[model samples]
Target chain A: MKYCENCRVSVRTGRETCPLCQAPLKGESEHLFPEIKSVYNQFILFFKILLTATISGAIASVAINLMLPESGLWCHYVVLGVICFWILLITAIRRRTSIPRGIVNQVFWICVFSGIWDALTAWHSWSIDFVIPCTCMIAILALGVLGKVLHLPPSDYLGCILADAVFGIVPLIFYLTGVSQFVYLSLSCVAVSIIALVTIFTFHGKQIRSDLARRFHV
Target chain B: MNQIRTKWNKLDNAAKLFPTASTRAETHVFRFSCELTEPIEPERLQAALDETARCFPTFGYVLRRGVFWYYLEESRLHPEVMPEQRPLCARLYRPRAKTLLYAVSYYGCTINLEVYHVLTDGTGAMHFLRTLVMKYLARAYDIPEENLGYETAHTSMADDSFRRYSHRAPIKRTERPNAYQLRGAKLSESRTGLIRGTMSSRALLDAAHEKKVTLTAYLSACIIAAIGEDMPLRARKKPVVLDIPVNLRNYFASDSVRNFFTPIYVSYDFSRRDGTLDDILAVVTETFARELDRDKLAEHFCAFLALEENPIARITPLHLKDIVMRTVYHNTIKGYSATLSNIGIVRMPAAFAPYIRSFHVCNATNKLQACVCSFGDRLSISVTSCFTDTAVQRRLFRRLRELDSDLVIETNLLDDDA
Candidate 1:
């Protein structure tokens, strides 16, 4: 038997919104609490699935290897991983996944690529540095030139790296001069960390401030 | 100058507009002042003036950078030239007389940089003032050129300097709901926004000390509560933010005065209704102490100046520069609701001190501007509204006295002066 004063809508007393007016109900200030209670919640879920799959795959591969040492059982596990990945990828593609979820999926694919690349290179006794950095550079440049926001040009990346390097130059100079290496590196790292922190903060700030403006009726 | 010119292509459009665009182009009238100290000498004044003029960056042509106008090459005595007057339009080598006390207010006083808001901001003007004094002191009193001041290969900027200027420097507590219609009335004229008492510098200090915060913080908190009680709309948040300008000289050491200080905006959400004069001070004092780290300050100083010294923009037409400066002004996040500049305890070297027994800080913009400055415990609360909104200015001082029951305020700016 609750009614909104402005909207004249009947709503449940304890509910957080009016049925007709859709006005936020009183005591619903908790709505301001961020939706994610913990970012670890995401990692935990991902970790659980990753651990289950990796453990099962490794166990199956080890069993097969023990049964037949001559046969490459790791190849079987790799095929199984591909199958599992396709299932998840198809599910993600079919449903409109959150941007963050999509990004995490993309990162997972990159990690998978790195893991397989490392394994293949290790098996062949080949160095990955010469190939990896160059491939990444070319790929990133192409992606950036293609207008992908995530893939920054090599020059732009180098600019940030150089900026970070210059930020550390003073402490680096002090270290190079044999003044306390520990302190200089620690200070230099702090300077490097600030770039990440500010970039992330402003990215969030621009969004948060915009949201605030709408809420505050600015 | 050549270094600046050589780096012209590297400069951005925003930097180009900084000098000329800084003039009160958006508002009604622009007002600013610079104070210089002299080393009690009459003989070396002329040399000091010439030397000071030569070294100061402000001495060169302003370029009317928005438009392609050149006055530096123009004849000083030409019919159109008023070399002594402050430039109404940019793009001129309007040489300011480089004497320690160039007084336009008094005779033998010149209308120099001190009188020109166009040449610099309060921060920029202060640098000129400090350098002018330092140079004069060194030359006249035979102080070393180092006393004239040497630039650090890179000066260590104190964090206080790079602080984002407050948009609405908040100062007050307990605002009421602003349900009443805001008809062309300035907020100051509203009955809800009046000072109830009078407190002198010493008393205000004593009050703040009792509350464990400085004078500014205490006054701001008290005002916040009063304002909160009046502003019904903002009750959703707590620990309302209060932006206070802490003079950089107090926190960091910067010999060059051009914008050496930035105002730190601190928030105090009174959501708990647990607001007190003391709680507000606790947070403010902590922030005031911590925000002025040297590295942060230096970065801000360099970044801000770099923005100002941008050469690419410098080469653009002044009209375009003005347009860009206007946009930049609009985009900025003006830190607080109101800013309080406490130019504490003015010590006017006896000679000049006698002529002015007391002074108050009153700065009004043609647009939405509100700022208060205090010296020797005397507070000046200046609010600017549209020229059409005359009622706002009339009620500002009166309402301020209304909020504080023990405050005794006097103003000559209201009726008689005009």
Candidate 2:
């Protein structure tokens, strides 16, 4: 009912100007499409503030270390620590949709970072002896419990459990190579891994095989 | 261990590129909507959608990532009918999530069906929207249900027609020069801007008959002329190419509701010839004659299928294949200036036609795209573009206005100075 003299076409919108030529329309109008509001993320400001605060903290630590040389080059560690924090935060945020995948990812990253941190501090081997084995064992148990409680499909959590079991076997290599000074935790981790693998293979063999076949199809 | 195994399907040959190349800016989601004379009743629409979903079981599948290729796995997610709240053609497939690839929403009198390209193409989506409208009308008005004949069998509806029609032949590759590209500031948040013009189909068909060309060819020529008017003198060396997608079901026997279309390029150099509507139409008509041949189109599609069938390409890991496919998609798009898809006529039963106003089709695109679909005498041509500049749209509509003075336009854009 609204006609634009410039474009010579009738428009069915409630706007004053023509959509094509921006000329004033000449009649009454009716709505054809609903007006959609722009999407705004409120957490954007929170993330911006967090990023600024971390960068300033790293800078301030470096400045303080330079002023006091006796601090013995500790500022580089602060910078690396900030970078490590971001890596972990990003990984968690990216995998937040899938709980099983997130747990598996967190276990891998936490063990790797703890090993590096322990090496930097000293050759205590606490990361290999305690952190790696304990994290792997806890992840395997948590996945099993959650799968049962949540009633997730066998295809969903079975693969994560298998992955964690494989990770659980890593401490065996550490125990054999003498990288782990205390042997009890690593041996227990190995025992738990073998038991979990046996249980899954005994019961959910078909599900795992189909899942693996589809995933690794090439 | 009493679990029923979920069925999964390999991505069709044309579907492989969409999962890799689709971005937030270009979601590769297309929409088909039916506007009834009466305001949509949500409960009846929901009931209708449930029945339609039961008919097309493939629409219930979700996109999943595999090591070698992305596949569609059957899921139990039920689609609900809600008021339209998101921007037009918003992103439907998110990475690492389990969700259906299509959505149904309503606004005022219109029932909108938005589908990701990986699920099906325009023809399939049109069939779905028609069925939903019919079912809703049948329930609401107490009209006897009439069968809108389509392949309702599960096996045939889910068939992979690309693999079925492709005969193993030597692949032919032709080098194409890059076409002219549109440049302008894009809409914020990567939203698509749609300007649809509805007019009498009989008038346009008469004009095409007078010109001795098909309606699609005539419209392509008009679009080429419009783009040519805006081209700078320096960019005249690059030809303006229009990529037209041909529905393979027309040339071959198929009952699939999945993707089975291939694009054929029609490029016209304004510098080489006088830039007029007639000149452009002559070029487009000739190109259509050569490209629309059965053997030529078969060769064209088979060449593409041969790449997917290659031993090395089949064995390559999906992550690496994603990188290569994404690169190829970007490069291939650069060879075309724009896309014009004519979904042809949409038919509904006579009993339901009294409740329907018209049907429209459009898609999200990084560049400009025009989608045409007709219902009754109403022909809806929806032009969608990411760029803020509307000169090409302005010229295209002005040209169309000359053919019919009863043109009616509608847009989703807001007034800036208001």
Candidate 3:
């Protein structure tokens, strides 16, 4: 299968040009991952890379903490894990391109998002504790760009952001009040992230249902 | 929502395009009844009507850009006008007849004449009109349908529609296609105008056949000549293009529910230009060759879409779009000395043969419109223009009668004095 760049039409396998527009393919089908596939493909990739990167970061931080007991560099490792997580998410949605194109697209969105986070923290006079959930909140909001390219409606993506803010941050609030151990805080954040992300993906699936029904009279 | 929109996104961008300008302000209904040499069978007649509709599916096409040649939807069956409010929009209203009335009802007048402008020219419609009547006759009369087919034989190639019909001079261009200047060109001082004329679709066709020319080419020459004689200032431009409507259904290999047409810019300039009838026929034939080409029509349709996107009012600046639209409305209304739509001759059943002795053609809500139709032996040419000059109309009829010698023209003038 291939995708028409101008109109975003899908061409069947081995087709020379898009039947509707008659434009030739520019080698989009040869790649392992098409820019637009099932939504599950995107979610799965992010989930896998996110697990890989974040778990390694956590293990490295634990090792550093045991080696230099007074250094307490685990905070830096967690923050670095989140930033890499952000970069990985943006690249998944952008067109399959050369390393430079991928880097450019990824970097542009990352800076824009990071800039908004910096401004919001400065305005609210938020502490380091707030930054973790705030970074997640903004990334959730940025999912709209993906939804539009995929022609999915905004409702579900917006719902995901709301869920992340409520579910991801409320426990942080609970932890800030000195209610739980550090292990529970980390576990709750991971659990909340899973639930919010799952809900967001499902909401988009509903939008797809209605859009498909309208087109086919199904 | 995501499931459906995802698939819809895959349809051609051309499928999503729609018309500008008072889109569907008038309805797009068309009807034709036929009388047979034998008594009509209701079922057979209905079957024939279906075939007639199948041929001219352009009623299914939609307008994009300035052309009428695009349809992208899976289903072309637009929702029928709700019976309740249908009366408010059109003055000519009728109660929904019985279920069997579908045959006749489907063939009633097409309301969306604005889209008609870009489709096959009136002469082309005349061919469709004739075929429709024949289809009905073949089914009702038990005659073979295949034998009633038509051949598009073009002979006289290049001639102006007006000159052979009327001895009018060409108008000179006072300005170029720069800023639209027709906004200030409204007629302030009233001139005496009296329009009286009649045309038989059969007679026009016969006249073109006699001269070996297409009906559109024949009438177009007369129209150009009339402009040359009537408004010499506006006739200076040579090789003028007419916005001849081409029915997309007959031409394009796509669904016919939307707008589908292209303009034929028939050139009026003649190499051996003479006022003789032979000279006129020569020019008309060649001019038609220059204007009518299927590929050019398709390209024109694309250009129209690129120039203007879908014109839904919510997202677009309505006030600005209207202002721009007004310029097009004024210039075409003014630029062309006049538009002549020969809704050529038709044959209807003897039942309807009584109520509709003669039918006329009028498009858009604009009073400046002019259309002529012929049924059987009866022909009527009608002009609906603002009450500016009553005498120009009188001159029009006078010249029309002088050319044909068998012209029977009548009119209903909407002037303030009356």
Candidate 4:
């Protein structure tokens, strides 16, 4: 091992200077462990470049729109769209540890954003009719399939699916209140949610109750 | 998803602040490492950890946030032993999770036990580490499980001694201006640079005897003098305070494996007196004598408990409480320059001593900290600091080297100049 005359300590690794005093080390040193690399680090440069480009593009578009009087305030849509996209992307990356939870989060956010975008354009009811119900239906199907493919226990995906099912059932209110211009997708989503809930109750009733108790236990 | 109710207990008085104060930069986790004569067997160590985890039920729980406060609930999730990797004493307890609060990992011959401060204090953690080493050695060598003399009953070991000893008295609170803070560039990637020195306990004890003061007091004085040397001229008006955590087990008879200690501040002002080792030692010894009283220490902790009992604090939601407690932690921690905790001597049976080399204890901090514990004749003083500069640590260790020229040191910091 290398020794530092100044710090009077033996350096275990091959670093040329003392860790404390920064004095030059003498003699050979040893390796402690293999170098570590984080998975996210490989894409860091790419992410940085992408972030710079997106930010610059947004700024340039807004600047050009301001410079030209005929362009109108359409750049606001681009800014808000970019912000919402990044928010959803970051959330998905953070929740990537659990696939079921990430799927549920994505389904919820995508439906909400599409609804907001549709409302911003006009009250076309596409958000409630197609986007909301379709997102919920796809989420239910994806969760059911992923549970089997990933070999997840009922405790892992039951709560997430239950949440999505409850959200899916909300559009039935739109149908009953005559807020939805189209009824086929909303009715289909409600049917799928009821079926999913009944299946979970029949198969994993005890697990759901126990999971709730553990989560809410004070 | 079994319907079994998990066992949990309230966070002790000293422990309540740590969970909120903890962040990725400065986690309130400390590590206890034991180097053996040979490399550890992965399978045997895993079996030993499972056996030891069952023995200490409080160590098996995880931290959870409730409506009003944060509590510990039993977790059926078994914490598997892995190789050490992350920066020293990184955050172990993330909120809203059901993982074990303590982790066990091995690197070469070292068996490291890192625990969140909310789970236990140094004394409590020492007991757990001792038991874990005993179990590992017994299994490794096929020795019969013998009474290592460190084992305590789970019921009393998990007792909240601070609550039991709290007395309802009008508390007096003394406020001091913030001490001179250590300013330096932090280490890269938030890593703590750990440098440890192992020397003869008798030699260091004799040096303390020559000073006519206790070992802890002598070391505290040395630390104060070290910081005093580096303080700017304008900053000398504020005292250089050393925060020392006193183990309450020495005064009160409680076998709590949870937190049960209080910190006493020892301030030595260089502006008033000449900054010498003698001057620092005198001030430290006087402060220790004045503050170590049983009733005085009780009142100090009871004052802390008073805040926890306030109706407003009680009614505050955990989210709001986290913010308030975190602010309080930041402001209160600034009151001290550094912390020095001496766990004192670690004694083991003769049968197990031969297999063990030594034991070390150190904590993570944004500032400097020295954790001292001895095994056999070796006094292991591990200095863990977050700063890139080593002026304070150099002075502290060099002063120690003057006492014994045969001091041997080991460290985990990689050089930047390399």
Candidate 5:
């Protein structure tokens, strides 16, 4: 035990000075608490570089557009595209712990951003016709395959599949509103969603019901 | 295959605030560690943890978010005993994570049990650590198993005692000026700094008896004086308040291993009263006398329950409730400068006493917190702070050293490179 003459208390550590008084101590040392290394996130520098590159690219694009009068105010597309990239990247990173949750969140953001992108580029209706329905269908199928392959308990992936199925049915609204020009993918998306819902309700009825009750309980 | 219905529980009255108010800095996680006479064996410790986890099923539950409040849902995740890797009292409950709310880790001769506040309080955590230690020692030494005197029934151990004892009472609110706040540079990465002082319990008890005050009261006065000495002249206008959490299981007839404690504030102003330990002890004793009454404590907790029971507050969505509760918790915490929690004496079977050295308890806090626990003649006062300064801890230990020169201090902080 090391005794600090200044604080007059014996310390049970390997340090040379007292923790309280910071004065020199006398005698041998004993280790009580283990030394923990500080956690340093290596991705911080990579993220910082990416952030700086994106901001500077956006600024330089805007500056070039300003210098060239015939460029026709196109810098906004670059700015919004950078913002959209970050939104998707952040959502993916935040939900990386749970694959099911990440897939569900990615589906939602991709559909929304794709639609916004299409609208900004003179509304080709491709986002609603192809992106929304195809994305939803793929998400539902991937969730089912991954849930089975990963052997995740129904409680973990059931809610995510149900969410993706619900999103699949959203294309029906686009079909009814006539926002979707081609009807095959939208109808197929709706059919897939209905079939998935039927399968879930037929087999995992009690599990989904209890999950809903728990999430929605007041 | 038939799916079995999982058990779920509502957050006890005191636990409701932790989910929303806890942050990376103050994780609302506390640790109770038992140091043994010999080095810990990993395989034996893991076996013991498995047995203990089976005994206390509530420890296996995971925190899940609901629309109205966060609830504990039974999960199949098993807690594995690993070597201590993270900092003391690291974050345990992530919002949507499916992991258990408690962890068991061992280092050298000590076995540590870190618990999220939402799962249980200090008293409950102590019971768990004791059981784990007892089980490990029994396996290592070939000792026979024995009962540890805690309720073994799963239903009773998981009961929410706050709802059981709450009565309809008129809520009382007393407005006062803000208490003194500790201002300084906090440690980086929101890490907690722990300095524990282990001394003979008999010496401190005799000192308290000579002054005709309880051990908790004497310690509170010592802490208040330590803070008072560091107070600037202008800061003296604000009283140094110590928030002491009283364990309710002592007054109520329940065996719940969940949270069931209420804090009562003891404020002492140096500008108004003579800044001496005697005067501070007298004030603290009087405050304890008035606040520790059975009826008053009941009424205080009932008032707390009243807010939860309000019709409007019950219907509000959880996102809104989280914001409001976070604000309310911040406002409420402003009324106290520090926290002092004494889990009282920890007892074990006589057969297992020879293998144990001492028990220590501490919590992660944004402000200074002192957790006291005693086993046999050895009493440990663990002081945890997020700030970088140690003046208050220095004074407190110096005062404690006056009582017994055999004080032994241990810290998790490394020496500064000067």
Candidate 6:
């Protein structure tokens, strides 16, 4: 073991440089063990670079917009867009372990972002009438097909499918509140959600109920 | 092929609290590591693990919560041996993620075995680690396997001693005021900071002999004194209690690998007397003398068994039980300031002794804990704390350094200045 005088800590792995201060370590003691390298270090470096690029882009755009008056607060949108991109990307990365869950999450977020963007751009109803219902229908179909084809144990994807189905049924609220004038997509979404829920309850009812209980366990 | 029926066993009394009390921060996981003279060969170690896993059948089971209680069911999942990349004693038994209750990993020359406390205690884990090391050395050096001389019977290793000894009358429980608590900013993500000191066992033993006390008693006194030095005067109104886990295998004639131990607390209040190491040792020595009896220990466990035997506790759903258990656990932890578990000396067959360096045991805790064990002339005292401050560790080690001037310290803290 070598003690790093600069950092005032002992280094058991005998590294050439202090892990904290990056200064060359001084003084030696009995070597107890070898140094271990973590796998997360590379991912951390990648995230650092990504953060620097995003921050630099935002800062530069703000400076450029301030210099040019005609841009008219577009930099705020740019900054928000970058933040949303990172949020969506990080969620996708975290849920990447489960394909069914990952797809469901992506579909949910895409629907949400689309609705927000549509409402901001003068509410043409494209989000609720088309984007949300279309996305929900595709998610329901994908989840329904993948649940079987993936050969996953029921405990693995049942909660995810049930959650997506519950989200899918939200379109019925739009129909009930008369917010959605075009009823074709909304009705289809409701129909698909109901069919999916019924199938899950019929074929894998016990497993789904037990899975929900485990997930909701406090 | 004939279909075989798998058997499940109920967790012992002491293990009942772990499944419900465990959280992301305190998973009740402890690790035992054996450092060899050279780097480990993964394939050879894996082969040894396969054989050792068969020897300790109860250790390979997964934990499952039943409608009324948590039980262990035999798992067919092959233990996956990997490299030690995670932090020390990271959460091992997360729900649905690799169902094995224990994990085996190696980093450089150290073979690390991290076991969930629900599976076994330090005594049981030590047996498994020793057997694994012996088998690995035997295979690597072409030594005879039988020379290891270990009992491989499944019954002997899986016997529930707690059940066998719980036939006594239950004692009434008494409530005591909370002990003095150690407060500090914890490390990020509940990571435990480890600071281990390596010293000569002969030197430490000689010092303990000079004090006319056992090494454990001496260390316990030192720990109490160290805590007393830093505790505020107002905080000293409550006693500073040290929770020491006693291995019942020494008193009982059982070879069970499941959890079978009880904690005996030794508390000392600074306000009541002038703080001195000798005064602290007298209290600890007297506490051990009174509480170390067979009947007294058994009665302590019987009270625990009485709780499990209550009809309402038995019939409640596991989720509801979890809420109650968590509350009980929070209050239970508040009763102690710190925990000190002395695993004592680790002995091995002579043939494999030269290949191993030392053995270390550390438990995950939100409070400060010190695990003391010895091998040959090397006495390894590992201090694991969730707090970022090393004040307690510094005082303890500096006190020991007065005896052995050549004490070597190894720590995982990012900086050494504290």
* Best DockQ among the predictions, by candidate number: 2
Per residue, candidate 2 scores C-alpha lDDT tens digits across B81-125 of 989999999999988788899999999999999999999998789
Error in Å for residue B273 of model 1: 5.2
Q: What share of the true interface contacts does each candidate keep?
A: 0.00, 0.63, 0.04, 0.22, 0.63, 0.08
**Model 6 Cα lDDT, one tens digit per residue, A167-186:** 98999999999999899999
Q: Write the per-residue lDDT of candidate 3 for residues B253-370, one digit (tens) a residue.
A: 4322222344444444322254444566577688667646665555555544444433352234434544565565556434333445545555555443443345445443222334
Measured against the true structure, the TM-scores of the candidates, in listed sequence, are: 0.39, 0.97, 0.40, 0.87, 0.98, 0.72
Question: Residue B38 in model 5: shift from native, Å?
Answer: 0.6
**Residue B141 of model 1, lDDT score:** 48
Task: Give candidate 3 misplaced runs (Cα > 4 Å).
Answer: A1-218, B1-18, B21-198, B232-240, B248-257, B269-280, B293-352, B365-372, B380-387, B390-394, B403-413
TM-score of 2: 0.97
Binned by DockQ into CAPRI classes (incorrect, acceptable, medium, high), candidate 5 is medium
lDDT of 1 by residue, B241-315 (tens): 544555555555444433344455666555655555466556667766676575544444455555544567445
Give per-residue CA lDDT, model 4, range A94-145, as digits (tens).
7776788888999889988988899888779999999999999999999999
Alpha-carbon runs more than 4 Å astray in model 1: A1-218, B1-63, B66-103, B106-118, B121-199, B234-246, B249-252, B270-276, B299-325, B333-335, B366-418
DockQ-derived CAPRI band for the predicted complex in model 6: incorrect
The DockQ values of the predictions, listed in order, are 0.01, 0.64, 0.03, 0.26, 0.63, 0.09
Give the DockQ ranking, best first: 2, 5, 4, 6, 3, 1
Per-residue lDDT over B1-418 for candidate 6, one digit per residue giving the tens place of the 0 to 100 score: 1122345678888999998888767879998999899889999999999988988888878776556777776766788789877777878876534378899999878899999999999989998999899999999998765543445578977888998888756546668679999998887767777778777899989988988888999999999998889798789899999999999988887778889899999989999977899889889889989999999899898899888888778778887898999898898888999999999999988788899999998889989899999999989899989887778887887787777766766766554323
Q: Is candidate 3 or 6 superior in TM-score?
A: 6
DockQ of 2: 0.64
Candidate 4 chain A TM is 0.89
Model 6 residue B253 lDDT score? 79
Chain B TM-score for candidate 2: 0.98
- Candidate 3 C-alpha lDDT tens digits along A1-218: 45556334333323444322345654443211112211233577867877787777777777777889787545554655476565666564442422222333453455455545655445442322344444454444455455466553343234434444454554455466654344453345546566655665576556534433432330
